[model samples]
Target: MNVAVEGRIEKRHISLSAKAKAYVALTKPRVIELLLVTTAPVMILAQNGIPDLWLVVATLVGGALSAGSAGAFNCYIDRDIDRVMKRTQGRPLVTGELTDREALVFAWVIGVASIVWLAIFANFLAAALSLVAILLYVFLYTVWLKRRTSQNIVWGGIAGCMPVLIGWAAVTHSLSWTPFILFGVVFLWTPPHYWPLSMKYRDEYKAANVPMLAVVRGRAVVGLQTILYAWATVACSLLLIPVAPMGIVYSVVALASGAWFIYETHRLYNRAIHGHEVKPMRVFHASISYLTLVFLAVAIDPLLPF
Candidate 1:
């Protein structure tokens, strides 16, 4: 009897631990990390230095909750198609680790919590922007656009750009032209960043009946579109040099990273036009590294003595 009780207790503990991990996975922590990366740097730039420690923490926590809420809602909405796509097949909803109802409730709870947190700790503007971000991701991107249009990610990506504005609002409690330029950088960057993933998984998106650009258009068209967007993204990043009047650090990093990004996109285009087997994941990986480097410069440039 004692041994059976102990065994049951251990099993229950393990089950609870697994459930917790599933809940975390449902939040899509990696996506939240990317959002937070944009947030902190913008906050630094807004203040023209590091803001208060607590305000930074509060805003980041709020941003993470909001991004997590969006991710959870996305998982619930896409659960059916997620099951069909190999890349998303392991998500909590598809894996049966989380029920759609549970995920939906979690999304609401965290979504509301994020707004309240930002309002109390950061500012009203920050809170409002976060609310807009949640709604945009849930409705505009996921519900209205994702399946209906091949240009889905092009507009859906606006939700991802909100972190920059939210971070600026947190520090300055306002809006400005500089953050809008940053916003453009991200908006244009999204296509090249995400389309490659879609390209690599073209068949999966097709099987799921999602209208990703890669599925709707031929490979060469998608590649050409990616290059166009990559160039526009680089152009927008350079605009910050004069707009924010950024110094050498940001200017150099932006130029170098943007060149590398454009180079990778050209490589994709070259392969597509030549009718060779295109390795899109290389461009996809390069896009992430490029964005990271550019933003790293954004965060560091303001702190320099020169």
Candidate 2:
């Protein structure tokens, strides 16, 4: 009896440790960081300088909850496919760190709580938009598109793009052509941003049967699409200068960074056509830096001047 009890205690400790790691995985912290980056610029741009403290706090909390909830729900829904993918095989659901019913409950709890918090603290518009984003990501992107087509990221990008609009509406309580343009920029940026990462894991994606672009069209087609979308993203970024209150400093940054983006995409495309694989990964990593700096520039444009 003593030996059995000791073994049980050891098993319980191991189980708990695994469960903690799974919970952290469910949060998808890197994706959340990109989402927050998208939100901050809108918050900064909404006001000429910095937004109100209360609004920023509310938006951040609400956005984090919604984004985290979406990620949890995605993990729950994709557990089977996740187990097949090397990158996601250790996720909470896939590893049995959490049960399906438990994850469902967790997701809904966070989702409803986030919506309520946003509605109560932020404007109803922001709250509604957040709900729409949640629905788009969960239903349209995850349920409908992910398995059906390689263009999954294209439409799914809409869900991620909403943080900008939500942040803008949180401050202004209204939408504008400028926010829409920001949405377009992010919408176009998403494909190139994701495809390189997808290319890196194409074999994993194929084994998992996820139908990513890299899996469907092969590396050459994916590379071409990345280049095409990168060009569109750069154009959209440039369009913001006139409509957005940004000035020449922004133009200079956009021009230099945009050119680099295109150059990287071209390099990737050339490599892909030649049956090489590493350049896309380089372009993929470069894209994160490109967007982060671009949005940061937007947030700080007031101080930079024309």
Backbone clash count for every predicted candidate, in the order shown: 0, 0
Residue-wise C-alpha lDDT for candidate 1, range 84-155, written one tens digit per residue: 999998998876676678889999999999999999999999999999999999999999999999999999
Error of 1 at 88 (Å): 0.9
lDDT of 2 by residue, 191-255 (tens): 99999999889899899889999998877888889999999999999888888857877778888
TM-score per prediction, in order, is: 0.95, 0.93
Tell me which residue pairs clash in candidate 1.
none
**What does the lDDT come to for candidate 1?**
0.92
**True-structure RMSD, every candidate:** 4.3, 3.2
| Local distance difference test values of all predictions, in order | 0.92, 0.86
Candidate 1's TM-score: 0.95
